[model samples]
Target chain A: MLKTRIIPCLDVIKNKVVKGVNFKNIKVMGNAVEMARYYSLSGADELCMLDINASYQNRKTFIKTVEAIAKVINIPLTVGGGISVLDDITDLLNAGADKVSINSAAVKNPKLIRQASIKHGSQCIVVAIDGKRHENKMKVVVKGGREITKKELIVWAKEVQSLGAGEILMTSMDTDGVQNGFDSSMLKKVTSNVSIPVIASGGVGNLEHFYLGHLTKSTGLLAASVFHSGKYKIKSVKKYLKNKGVPVRL
Target chain B: MKKKVIGLIDGQSGNIGSINKAIKEIIKGRPYQLKIIKGEFDNSLFSKIILPGQGAYATLISNLKKLKIYKPLKKYLDNNRSYLGICVGMQILSDQGHEDKTTKGLGIIAGEIKKFKSKKLIIPHMGWNSIRLNKEDPIITNNLDNKDFYFVHSYIFQNIKKSNVLANTHYGKKFPSIIKKGNIYGVQFHPEKSHKYGLNLIKNYILKS
Candidate 1:
């Protein structure tokens, strides 16, 4: 059986890993390689390394970071941030990354998703959508969850899937740092509307949150503060989910 | 003398990082020279060849043929020189693959790769899973006893002759985790991405020669 995935996202700047509240006021966590190795051993299905400074640098550092982590951890690694071109995706894949997550790039040019999927296969491309509940509707955000896009959440997700994205890493910007739990209502709206796998992110403060997140049609769960700051280990989360009758890798 | 090697049948497809990493790890403490050859494969310069892949079975078979290394690879395996395959590389050894559509394989093994269609299970079984040993094969010895290794594929080798199955794993079905006959060894999982147990498995294969 294909178990639901538990992914820990790392926000890397320069060469160090940093975590912040609502994507601001950053604080250094620890060594990127060490953190990645810990997550891999702690039973994380995959790890996402987002180069938060990728747009500013104009050069993708996620690929180099992925290579470093790949040397230690034996799990799938997805590299994102500043992945604007087909060559960027190809370079990361060649550098041992299992998948590439596109956020701002995909929003700017949705065709990149179609092109990448055709050349590298849909399984290798992940379309990450950062959204917020706006005006009674979920809206997409870009530039590391700073700028809002004109497209609606469900509409853009369907378009991206139609364009050949294999999975959706949907994050709720409103509940990102709130720790209230995932926005299940919004998750259900987006996930139920798409046929591809949806990974729910944001507002995960406890095991119950993960349980609820899974029930909302998400194929995977993503967290940072809870998993990174030692609030909870992924093994414990998977165990909890297993006990709750939720299918997870234990 | 340093042993020179050739990776059989290079194409624009397949995961090359895994193959390169496996070879490097295999010869970590040994004396051996390795080279990745493309277009045409001349068997005389290498003592062993590795076939690594991650994609559909038909694409891999077609790519190998297009590169013109398919015949040479077949010839190498017939003469009984060392060869190692990972993931889809292992699937291609079977008589056929049943993904998207039925397609023919390299016919190295007596079985066919079947897709799991149970509504109870999900396609592409991805993550760390345990393997139960059926028989003693050198590639999986010592390290494979009740040990879990990472896996990320959908199809499993079915109807495999008991003589060729080296290891078995239970997902939705009991399937071959490792298959070996003569000089050919096929692993359904990516050993390069599977940590110590996986590294040790590759080391065992290198040590066998």
Candidate 2:
């Protein structure tokens, strides 16, 4: 049977993990690879490392970071941020990333998503939709949520699926890191609309938030700060969800 | 004991990094040499040939035949050597594939690769899923029974021979996850990305098989 994936996300700034783990009990030093291995051993089904570097030169450094993480751990790694053209997808996938997450650049030119899924298989291409709500409407946001595009949420998601993207990583800027919960209704709208797998990201503050995020029927649940702060381990979270009747791998 | 050589057939377009790293890590301090077969490779140099694929089945059909990797690979398989196929590599053993288009597979196993048809389940079947062993092989099924391996694909073998299927996984229906006939072994999961269980599977395939 297929189980809900518990993904631990990391913010990579030029090959180093920032806003990372500070364990109060365990004496663990957090590097990109160490923290990645930490999460994998802690029972994270997959790991997503977003290159938060605003600088252009950090592209090379991010690839190195991806290679480093891939060498140590043996789980799927989805690298996001700054993926514009076909070559960006090639470089990251060659550097040992199982999947590449394209956000803003895919919206600017939707053909890149098609070209990518055609050249590389759709299994490796993940179209990340960052959405934000305004006046009873949820619009697609890009450029790290700085710029909101004219594309609506569900329409763009259906478009990417038709364009050959295998998965959708829906992150809502409004609830991101806010400790409230995920945009469950918005995620439900997108997840039910698309036939592909939808991963619910963004706001997941408490343990129940993860369960609520999964209740949206998103196959994968991704969280960052909660796991990084050592407040909740992936194992404990999976246990919580398992007891709640969620089929999680223990 | 003579040193054993493990040939990783790289079609050049496929992702062979994690597999290469896994082979290297597994054979550390052991009397084994890892050979990556990209263009031309000698047929007799390897004891085991592994085709670790990640892309679509159509691309596998094109790139494998286009590159110099085909003739030697066919020779290796025809000779009945220990061959392990991962994901697309495993799917290519079918007679035909319908992923991108109507493409032909190696036909080592009698089946047609088709997309999953279920309104209730998600496409791509991406996650950690368990394997149900049909006929246990000491090397392949060793320590891997009922353990969830990472699977990320949209296609599966529809009419695979029941006698050849070593293990099967369930989504909305039962599908072959591990198929083997003689020495040709194929698994429809990413062992290189499946952490310890995956690494152990690889090590067993390399050192023991």
Q: Which candidate should be chosen as best, given DockQ against the real structure?
A: 2
True contacts kept of each: 0.21, 0.85
Number of the top-ranking candidate, with lDDT as the measure: 2
Give the CAPRI rating of model 1.
Answer: acceptable
Q: For residues B1-209, write the lDDT of model 2, one tens digit per residue.
A: 88889988887545888899999998889998888887778879888888888768888767888887777787777777889999989888888999546998787878999988988788889999998889768556565888889999888988877999989999999999998888999999999888888898888888777
**Tens digit per residue, CA lDDT, model 1, A1-250:** 4467889989888567898887689899988888998998888888988887775553445556778887777767888877778988988888778888999889999999999977776767889999987788789987656788799999999999889787888988988887899989889998778867788988999889999998996878998889888989999999999999976766
Q: All candidates' lDDT scores?
A: 0.80, 0.86
Task: Encode model 1's per-residue lDDT on B106-201: one tens digit a residue.
Answer: 788789988765755533565667788888777778757667677767678898899888788888778888888898989988777766787788
Off by over 4 Å in 2: A20-30
What DockQ would you assign to candidate 2? Answer: 0.76
Candidate 2 global TM-score: 0.95
lDDT of 2: 0.86
